[model samples]
Target: MNKLRIGIFLGITAFAIGFAACSKSDSSANKPDPTENGFDKTAMLTNYADNLIIPAYTNLQTQLGVFETAVNSFMATPTFANQQALKTVFKDTYLKFEHVSVNQFGPAEAALYTNFTNTFPTDSAAIEGNITRGTYNLTANSTIGQQGFPALDYVLFSPFHLNDFSGPNAANRKKYVQDLVARLKTLTGNVLTGWQNTYRASFIGNTRSDSGSPIAFLINQFAFEMDQLKGPRIGWPFGKQSAGTMFPNNSEGFNAGISVALATENLVSLKAMFNGNGSGKGMSDYLIALKKDKLSSDVMTQFDKAINALKAVPDPYATAMSVNKTQIEAAYREIQILLTLIKTDVASATGVRITYQDTDGD
Candidate 1:
């Protein structure tokens, strides 16, 4: 969830703007087909599509179904008990989102899921503005910050923390919450449908490793998500960019204070996707075929380091940014190491040109 940027995907390049894979050389597909190395690109693609990408979206659909029903129950009852239930399912669904987030190339790009689904420290002013107005376009790009899981995090835990669902502005607040979940369900479900209906066959069929190939998109996004973990998810709130001044509230899921868990889950997703979610053919397998086994092994080792470091940080991450400063800094450093490995070392090894602009200059 980016803070400084709103329209951009923060880490991913402009594949969502158009058919960037066809014309752009730096985003998704940028490397020549490496089939000469006997890595079985088609098999890798099939494994990713069948085992990793599609399955992630499918699970997300299930969690979102649960989340929508939870919202329905809460809105119907508007009680403290129902509110807590909604919070539980919200975190579950948000965690599921971390998995699908890595596959933000084919159908996810078509849905602009990256652009809308996760931006935080959400626009509190904009969100309140929409709620008070009692009408706003949740689907519009202008409403991006107010449209995602982060926004729901705030709506669920912070603003209405005192079980105000049945109190002041009850109708408007309930309507806003309902609209947010509805938008999330519709947009995310459409992405899943796109994958199941058509994108799956094409993604597994095209084995070419061009500037627009699915392999490049997957690998590029792997690094992009890692970069995001290093910066927005960890560094920005830890004050890596602001002269050692902490903006702890900038933490993703700040209101719910699940920042550490979200960051840990993001790293876990990248590592899982990289290693084929445990057993399938992933980028590490391709690296092994190319005889870059050390790089492959180093990447996994660093993923462990990063995940462990992040998990070391206590919950309510914003508060920990001050109370647990040393632990937060250590986690940030490990995340930086992982980013360098994936974006630079691994990108070079895989033959994909990584391109995404950020002011942090890391």
Candidate 2:
């Protein structure tokens, strides 16, 4: 071969080799390990811990503080004015609870934060029985229906239920309300401290996709939160789970007439968590990194569609549920479709195995 031809051929070979090496490095950087075309789990975890999780807990703690103050003020006089003020703050703080509800792992799981904080249509019967008897354990799991936001909903907004604070059973009723708020404060505060003090570092550092890793836990808990939104938050009260029995008051915050508001907030936070609280490092980013762009886009689109449908529902969801069942069911169907996308498509793309047991087979 001629000298010029040989020199050009060697240059081309070197250039090809260098380009191949660069491509491989780019793909490897996206992975959980040394494999090509993977994601940086640590970066995702760090984004979640720092941006999404901490901020959510801190905001919730701030709302909780305001809520506790409201409780104290109401206890001081138990006047109608105090009752109204307390109810306002109670609803705000309860809505804030949805922000941190999806993070039910590690400290939250240990705290049983969601179950303790928002279990609803709280058992008014159980709460009343506890107050009448002047005996109940606030911390016990079985007493969930007797405590939390729902119980407070009953205490503050149920039909003339708050009148007992000025009636013969005043002291007992007041004591029960005080204890319920205290339990919520303690459980929520502990989980926030857990995340802030040490769990943050632990979560960011352990960057595996295994069942116990941050990814697995986040995805699993995310699905669980969605299921809660679909089933307990809407379905049960809508009679989807009761053969169309239509228990409107069974909805969360129904006594306070804020069921739609709470459900909307819960879903808003879920979408934020799915998108990394707008930090640009959420599951959507992870999926996009894997070149699943269409899946990522579709999930987000569904989220928007669901949120819009939910917003279209009239307020006072409890009363509206009876006549507007069709509209509410339309919103519920949208939520269910979003749930399916996350469980099947998002879970499949991320490779995070969902460990939560599902009865509805989402």
Candidate 3:
């Protein structure tokens, strides 16, 4: 009878052990997956869509409307007051363009919107050809250099060509300005409407970092703009391109003498996008989510340094290029540091591949 009791007791102990093991297994199964525990991709995308991207496009559209009105007023009167007002409006619109230019995806990319609106260092010969012909196609790739804000700059501010707006060619020049502004207004309007009506939903829905994801596209565009800031806007004019030979004429806003101002605006827009301007989550928050606190801080600090350096550069950037080249180079170096941080550290931490090619070697 004692032996029988011992067998029963052993069986009970074995049952208890099995039951405990099964309980532990169930608890583990009920726990949340590590990948999904902290990250909320939907929230991030929603914030970007609702806060940063839409508002930027809206502001650009509004500014372009004002610009078009100013152009129309100037064309009607062609007086000094009207011309100055038009120039002021043009500057304002161009500054607004800087904010949205970094967003090179969706409708903007499909429309080649940047090329249509702000391609720089205007082709003087091509612009003259278009004006002389008066029958050229602004939509053609061939006219990209002749149809953007830079072309307007030529007609409005070129010292020798100031006559282009007030002399024998004035009629042709005015027509060209009117046409360019009209096209710019339409294109910008379309992009803004697209985001509001359709693309915003798709952009927010794409939360993955796959090839065509919004995050990937944003990163790619951000990188491309950084290269633009470093190379064409600053370096090319500073002579960092063209084998260390200074090309003051290549400066953006060369005719308007607002190159530094334009660069400052571009830098500010970049920083705003990076930080989301405190309105919502941005790339900085994404980096933090990836546990890249140091990288996030580093990138923000470098951007501040670059911006400060740019602010210190003298305005009338064409003049500064000749007399204060050192300051320009200083700003260029700071931007280069930022380029490395974003291209390497941020890209790696976020798993974003840098798809933009740096052709200038600066």
Which model is ahead, 1 or 2, in terms of TM-score?
A: 1
Model 3: per-residue Cα lDDT over 1-362, one tens digit each: 12222222233233223333433444333322223227666677777778887888889888878887887787777777677677778888888888887876677766777766767777788778878987788888667677677778877767766545667878888888889888887888888899999998877765666445677677766767787788778887676755777776777777777888888899899888887777777888888878888898999999999999999898888788778877888999999999888877777888876644555543
Overall lDDT per candidate, in order of appearance: 0.78, 0.75, 0.74
- For model 1, how does the per-residue alpha-carbon lDDT over 209-274 read when each residue is reduced to its tens digit? 544677667767887787788778888778777899888777787877688988889889889889
Q: Lowest-scoring 10 consecutive residues by lDDT in candidate 1?
A: 7-16
Better of 1 and 2 by lDDT: 1
RMSD, one per candidate, in order: 2.7, 15.9, 18.9
Q: Tell me the RMSD of model 2 versus the true structure.
A: 15.9
Question: Candidate 2, which ten residues in sequence have the lowest lDDT sum?
Answer: 1-10
lDDT winner between candidates 1 and 3: 1
Judged by TM-score, which candidate is best?
Answer: 1
Off by over 4 Å in 3: 1-37, 79-82
lDDT (Cα, tens digit) per residue for candidate 2, span 1-362: 12222222233233223333433444334334412256776777788888888888898888888888888888888888888788789889988888887786768766666667766667777778898999988887677556788888888778877677889998998888888877887888899899989888777876556556667677766776677667767776677766887777777787778888888998898899888877557888888888999999999999998888888888798777867878888888999998988887788887876656643445
| lDDT over C-alpha atoms for residue 238 of model 1 | 81
Model 3 Cα shift for residue 290 (angstroms): 0.8
In order of appearance, the predictions have TM-scores of: 0.92, 0.87, 0.87
- Tell me the lDDT of model 1 at 188: 83
Candidate 2 residue pairs in clash (backbone atoms < 3 Å): 30-38, 30-39, 31-38, 31-39
Against the true structure, candidate 2 reaches a TM-score of 0.87
